[model samples]
Target chain A: ELKVEQNPLFLSMQEGKNYTIYCNYSTTSDRLYWYRQDPGKSLESLFVLLSNGAVKQEGRLMASLDTKARLSTLHITAAVHDLSATYFCAVNTGGSNYKLTFGKGTLLTVNP
Target chain B: DAGITQSPRHKVTETGTPVTLRCHQTENHRYMYWYRQDPGHGLRLIHYSYGVKDTDKGEVSDGYSVSRSKTEDFLLTLESATSSQTSVYFCAISESSGAPHEQYFGPGTRLTVT
Candidate 1:
């Protein structure tokens, strides 16, 4: 079984502060995805890290993957109130089909 | 937003009653998936379809069933509703099950069983 663990499930940070949400998975797989969900809304894809050393950034959020370590990280730089949401990391077991195992998600609260 | 929609956005039912959730997509994607989101369980895949009449179970597929008669529609049915089955259900679509392709989610259907 593939297990995904995320730390600081509940995070409170101030605007302009920097924080990182970590996602660690068990087993060997190469695909990792970051998704954001607002309260009572559907999830939106944030980043997809396909290989080791893969990194992608958008706005104030950056995500990186280290396949060898079975770890991925979502770095938030200069957070804003709009960044308050639940972030999830999902991993795909190596296969031709799409079967994702997701973390419990980190609920981030950005205060002004 | 993707052209995916889930019917019965909010539903309240009693235990032992049969419940069915409908997912419709206009994107013509080749893959469709059903997932349930709980407070501590981020998202658990219940079932997925690769094509018409081609469905497979996921990690938490017990007591749940799915049918995909066409490419644009996927239906998830609960044989008998239970309190443990109450959760927010989401339908997702992807162009392909291959790597590097992201799945787009529907707005989700909130189901409650008493």
Candidate 2:
């Protein structure tokens, strides 16, 4: 069974501060994904890290993947109120079926 | 929004009642998945379909059933609704099983069992 673990499940940060959320998986997988969900809303795809050392950045959020370490990270640079949302990291076990195992997710609250 | 939609956005039902949720996609994706999200469990897949009429169970498949009669529709059925089964169900569609293609989620169906 594949297990994904994320650190700091609940995060509270002040505006203009920086923080990083970590995601670690148990199995060997090359594809990793990051998603964001606001309260009572659907999930939005943020990034797809296809291989080791792959990194993607959008606005104030950045995500990176290290397949060898079975780890992925979502880094927040200079947080803002708009960045307050629950972030999730998922791993796709390579195969024809393509199922994703997701982490518990980190709920971020940015104080202005 | 890959043209995905879930029916019965919010439903409140009594325990032991049979409930079915519908998921429709216009993107013509080959794969569809059903997942439930809870407070601490994140998103756990209940079932998935690789093609029309081809379905498989996921990590949390007990007490839940799914069927895909056509290419665009997937249905999730709860044989007997229970209070513990009350959750936010999400439907996702994917074009392929490779890189450069990611699953797109629907608006989700919030089911409450009383």
Candidate 3:
């Protein structure tokens, strides 16, 4: 079984602050993906980190992956209330067209 | 938007009843998937289709069955609804088959069994 662990399962921060959520997997993976979900809402794609030292940014959200460490981080810059949501990271192992294994998720709440 | 849609955004059913969830896509993508989301467990794949009439089981396929008759539509059926089957089901699609592709998801369906 592939295990994915995420840090700080729940986080609360004020607007204008910065924080990073971490995702670590048990074994090698083909790729990493980040997703955001608001309460009762569907998942919204945030980032797709494909390689070692891979980094991608969209607005205030930035994601980075370090395959050597089997770790990925989602950094939030200048957080806003609208950024409050549950964030999930998924990994697709390269073994024989494997399914996605997801983290437990980190629930972030940005206070205004 | 991937133009993926899941029918019956919210549903309530009784135990022992049968229910079917629909996932329709307009992107003409070759890959489609069904997943169930729950607290602490994240998203667990129920089934997936690579092409028309080609469906495969996922990790949580025990209580679920799936059929894909058309390229754009995938159906997931619960043979006998149970309380443990209550979850939020999501439909997703991907445009590529090589390696891992980013999956685009629909709004999701919330099923409650009482």
Candidate 4:
């Protein structure tokens, strides 16, 4: 069974601060994904890290993947109020590689 | 928004009652998935369909069943609703069962079994 774990399940950070959410997986996987969900809303795709050392950034958020270490990270640079939401990291593993096992998600609260 | 919609956005039912949730997509994607989100558990796949009449069980598919009779519609049925089944169900669609094709999600349906 492939398992994904994320750190700082609940985070409250002041605006303009920097923070990183970590995602660690148990098995080998070539693909990783980051998603964000607002309260009572659906998930919004943030980034897809396809290879080791692959990094993608959007606005103040950056995501990187290290497949060899079975780890991924979502870094928030200068967090803002708009960045307050729950972020999730998912991994694709096993034979089919179509199903994704997701982390418990890091609920970030950016306070001004 | 990926043109995906889940019916009965919120539903409450008693235990042992049969409940069915509908997921409809206009994107005509080749892959459709059903996932349930609970506090501290994130999202767990319940079932998925690759094509019409082709479906497969997911990690938490014990008391759930799925049917896909058309390209744009997928149905998830709970044989017997249980209190443990209460959670927010999300419907997702993807262009294909391959990497880089991110899954587009629906608004989700909240089901509460009493």
In the order shown, the chain A TM-scores of the predictions are: 0.97, 0.97, 0.95, 0.96
User: Compared to the true structure, candidate 2 yields what TM-score?
Assistant: 0.97
- Lowest summed lDDT window (length 10), candidate 4 chain B: B94-103
- DockQ for model 2 equals 0.82
Candidate 2's residue-wise lDDT over B2-102, tens digit each?
89999999999999999999999999899999999999999999999999999999999999999999989999999999999999999999995456668
Per-residue error (Å), model 3, residue A15? 1.2
Calculate DockQ per candidate and list them: 0.89, 0.82, 0.65, 0.82
Error of 1 at B28 (Å): 1.1
After superposing candidate 4 on the true structure, give the runs of residues whose Cα lies further than 4 Å from its correct spot: A94-97, B97-99
Model 1 C-alpha lDDT per residue in residues A6-76, reported as the tens digit of each score: 98899999999999999999988868999999999999999999889999999999999999999999999
Task: Please provide, for model 1 over B18-89, each residue's C-alpha lDDT reduced to its tens digit, 9 standing for 90 to 100.
Answer: 999999999999889999999999999999998999999999999999999999999999999999999999
CAPRI classification of candidate 3: medium
Give the TM-score comparing model 1 with the true structure, all chains together: 0.97
Give the clashing pairs for model 1. none
Report model 1's chain A TM-score: 0.97
Model 2 stretches astray by more than 4 angstroms: none
> For residues B1-113, could you state the per-residue lDDT of candidate 3 as single tens digits?
88999999999999999999999999998888899999988898889887899888888899999999999899999999999999999999987556447888999999999
* Candidate 2 local lDDT, A5-42, one digit each (tens): 99989999999999999999999876889999999999
What tens-digit string does per-residue lDDT give for candidate 4 at A2-112?
789999899999999999999999998778999999999999999999999999999999999998899999999999999999999998753453778899999999999
Q: Which candidate is the best by DockQ?
A: 1
